[model samples]
Target chain A: MPKSVTLKDVAAKVGVTSAAASMALSGHERISEKTRAAVKQAAEDLGYVPSSAGRALRSQRADAVALVVPNSSAHVFGHLYFMHVLTGMSTAANAHDAQVIVSTNADTSNGGVAYERVMRSRTADGAIVTSAAIDDHHVEGLVASGLPVVLIGNYPHLADAVSVGIDDVAATEQLVEHLVTEHGRRRLLHVSGTLDHQTGIDRRDGFLRAAEMHGLTDVAVIEGDLAEESGAAAVEQVLRERTGDERFPFDGIVFANDDMAVGGLAVLRRAGVSVPGDVAVVGFDDFGFARVTTPGITTIRVPAEEMGRIATERLFDLVDQRPGGRAHTELGVEVVLRGSCGCDPERAAAPGPTHSH
Target chain B: MPKSVTLKDVAAKVGVTSAAASMALSGHERISEKTRAAVKQAAEDLGYVPSSAGRALRSQRADAVALVVPNSSAHVFGHLYFMHVLTGMSTAANAHDAQVIVSTNADTSNGGVAYERVMRSRTADGAIVTSAAIDDHHVEGLVASGLPVVLIGNYPHLADAVSVGIDDVAATEQLVEHLVTEHGRRRLLHVSGTLDHQTGIDRRDGFLRAAEMHGLTDVAVIEGDLAEESGAAAVEQVLRERTGDERFPFDGIVFANDDMAVGGLAVLRRAGVSVPGDVAVVGFDDFGFARVTTPGITTIRVPAEEMGRIATERLFDLVDQRPGGRAHTELGVEVVLRGSCGCDPERAAAPGPTHSH
Candidate 1:
């Protein structure tokens, strides 16, 4: 056991040629970036632990990672928030002895093509992507094919690739300031889904900047595909705009998740409508059927499997070329309080509250 | 593409030495099973299609597959039946340009030690496993480490591996003959989850063989771990064995899933009972919170992402060694109806009924 370090001991401490120290310790582009930093500093001065079977025989790296998602986002597989971010990216890629390989998109407009043939057959070492869309040429062909891609949400025009998200504009401006200061409410509506998804354009710009810091002006948005029959057809198109007469009555709705707030509380219980006494319902991703639905649902939680375990541990610190953290990570959001936002009906009819989020 | 037959043209038509035709076309144990079937019959008589970079430069095949599961199956990531069998095994491993990886178990008592270190670092070319238990030395250490494992559920004492499942004892005797001949319900209970799982011993031997083929000898059983707080603590231990007087009268129960029938319908809606009027519930995996739980449970659906898309298309037909199918496949199961097994209270208070499941 004391004699293990090979690639001929980092090519005899970098005097080179063990196929140039296995193509400069497998970063490979036919070596020379100053001999791949002198065969990675002679494999960290000969500790040489590179055996994922010698990096899958010099750079075919099947330690696996992939994730990908986007089969044209068909409600991301009936969302348990992408199955708790694929079980926190398979329990942080099984605590780093990695393997996650999800892949889906049979061509979300050419974005996955089996995730660009598993990163051109190197067969995966990095890739997280999740439903990315802003200027996404499949995340610009995985950052123009250089590889180790990350992007779970924000693109910020790919400035140095990696990403991870949460601040859906300050958790939809603290759930629209708890529906306008602890339920005083105002004519807000939202609904949303396909604003070409940057989390539906930062939660419809945090529900119009919390209805313009409370000077509320009858907000009303709509468009949905984040299905629960598109939030019960946006509450039957606002009950045919209040029985064909522009009564404009939405005293608060929000949605954009929790399976469209359990289809807007079963279309406001088949239209008798009296949640928070008439409308107030919020939702984001406090999902497990938002505490078994019947009157419980005021949400925002969103640590969706801790943003899939910190975006696969920041794409394995950008696939082991680790450096500093925060390559734009975000995560942090929670609001909770249930009983359709009217307040805690006995801890919202109990069941899942062992300190949520 | 016509000139793609490489490995030095099948080692110059098998006269050998292209590194012994890349270790006898990668079945590698340092060659010689009669030179690995004559370099796979001279690369299949020169048609030669091997290139996942020539099978990852001779079989370090990160062409990926793994799935695994068992991190002590804590309701397998809030089960949408394992996210529709991981989206039917990632759409049949993205139609065979393969890559699926999931993995999970960071030790469910060694039943997938990170899926046997991603198949001993060959970085996965086989393995499916998901929830298998009976005699499972983590699926007999993946069929005695010969690799290409398949399991999904069933052990049948390993007899030459490959498993795939469904038919949990004839889908629990067609859900206990629809609760004893279409809701006659002669005293049954079940609940189950931890019968050391071969799907809780084939749904408790299909509920005691449909209570001894309906001769109805008051059945009971209990155990649970398939959480919703273990079916709300097995309905408070059968309501403390019927208010402490051993007055045993359980109309019908069943459970085994749908997160313990949504915690046994919130403990029969906080004990007022009346589901199918005083008790009748059935559940197996027809989850999407089994149609927004109020009275909508009547269950047993399980195609669980079409048995994870036919056990990952028969583990990609045993990772392309391809023979015909059946190494114990199983599939087919559906029962569905609603209103807590009584029958359609207006199609279970109508919400998701476009024929669910």
Candidate 2:
């Protein structure tokens, strides 16, 4: 391979001091435009490469931030859905002339503590934390350390920390209301994540609020772990327990996320249960595959990428020590109407006997 | 937040020189076991966080490697499947006491030129290149630079760089053979990726080879960009051109990846085609959602995470100037039979179909 061209080469070619060339390349106002142009031309000619680390060392900022998630490394690549949020953050960061460092806890053993190591050691100027839990000690620690940190999800007590997230409760309420009033569905099953998580808690509260508003007090709730298997297992349990009900146990189902909803859809399809005809379903987090599924999935669309970008930008603002900045941000969510809910006008208007709430 | 404990604090607590304390914490052979234990105890008591970057600088190594993909940051995180591979690399790297830097040239105006910038600047000690094409200039340049580089997929005419990839051709051949011989599939339709990409070329080649071996020459091939939209578009084109044939144009369809296959499945289902009964379909890269979908997709399971780990280790080995190492590695792939391609009797007879291939 050819030897890399150094700043020295550019300086020599331009017949200027290395300091002058550096200043010119950095676009220092003190440098003359003619000398800056000369040095730049020389740099281009010689293919002089600038070192981000070196520049960071001199400037005391790397112009890069780390996006830290807590999980085993293997899980990072295998989970394709995260790619969307990551893409959004990267695009926004790049637009700001910054780079991203993706890191996770060393192992599952340490959990939140591993993040402490990254922050204490100043691995990156700031960090964006995703999939954050309500009692995330790592985030609390980072906030206490005066580090610039942004979270993709909200934690109730971390009022001092910058965060960007969807209003899960409001979004869930919207979906439930649509299913109950608009679709005229009475019996409903809510497949949800562990209630301890903020997302799960908020979504469940929203569903309950909607049920109360619509006077549908007898809603069945099944706990799931936000995984496909969990959804399938929950469905199986529901099916077994609802043996001799005169009215179908549930005419509508709402899943905490798209993955679980999809799983539930699969189980229902395999059992020869009619979707939207016998039952209607809605999911949260409008994932890419939601639309591709048969009958599609009516769901709440969380602006995943936008949330990531905003979170990162908020962290950068903190890193830059912006004054009088607030810590919490809540992004918007939308209800997407699709085939799975059987709400298509044609399907709803069909002449066949229709079940009403 | 409380101030982070530093090396000085550890040394003060241990009643030893900072160098001695550092050596003890590093587990250097020069330090006595008793001294190491005492130093470690002191560090633990004080909550001293060792600096990975500083330690790497002292050791004349970065203790970090870069996983470089020639895509934008948004693209990197948009796909959920990549999370697993990234997770695998991170987990393995952490096991070896290393960190990973995920770099992309997605925004670079000049194609493949970012590799030159990264290498010339020595931003990473070594790098793992994923989804490499046959004529990838980045691989060629890295090889020429004598850098510790590993390719996750095959690259043409580059003999000196280490590679870790599945045999795309063989895996595709096995998938096709299973469809033709066991499932009685005929008139195959192949949905392939862009022909320029190595994986796309090899998979297409394997499909054709299998067809030749089975004495089934009546085959149709459609090109796609290995995305859900591409898959949907390809299926749409095929359906439009079929001219109402009584026999379905193809009894079996093979897709480049799960994303495309899922898209194609959606289109077919919407058109009232019974999966596996009227048409059988197979996808590559058995992603997480493949099983959760109705009629769970049949696919070729590539060891994405394992390959990532192997590539990272090999890159590190090369960076460390290890002796007597080969320049390439071929990882294995397996065929996963699921409901989409018709149930596997053997699998059905066994415990469950949930096993990873």
RMSD of each: 20.1, 5.3
Alpha-carbon local distance difference test for all models: 0.73, 0.73
Expressed as tens digits, the lDDT of each residue in A302-352 for candidate 2 is 888788778777877777777635667877788899867876644233221
Task: Give interface RMSD for all predictions.
Answer: 13.3, 9.4
| Model 2 iRMSD vs. native | 9.4
The residue-by-residue lDDT of candidate 1 on A1-357, one tens digit each, is: 023456776887768778788777668887779978988887766545444546654554556677777556754764566778888887788777666777776844432366765665555677787776675476686676667877777776676777888788788888889888988898989988888768887888888888998889988888886778889889888888685544338878898887877887776665556676667788887768877765667888877788888888888777787784767888777788887877876534443211111
lDDT against true structure, model 2: 0.73
Candidate 2 local lDDT, B232-308, one digit each (tens): 89988988888765545888999988888988876776565767777888999976556655566889887877888
| CA error at residue A303 for candidate 2, angstroms | 1.2
- Clash tally for model 2: 30
Off by over 4 Å in 2: A1-18, A29-47, A71-77, A107-112, A245-248, A345-357, B1-60, B72-77, B107-112, B244-247, B344-357
Q: CAPRI band of model 1? A: incorrect
Query: Tens-digit lDDT track for model 1 on B192-254?
Result: 888877788788888889888888888888989788889889988888768555433687888
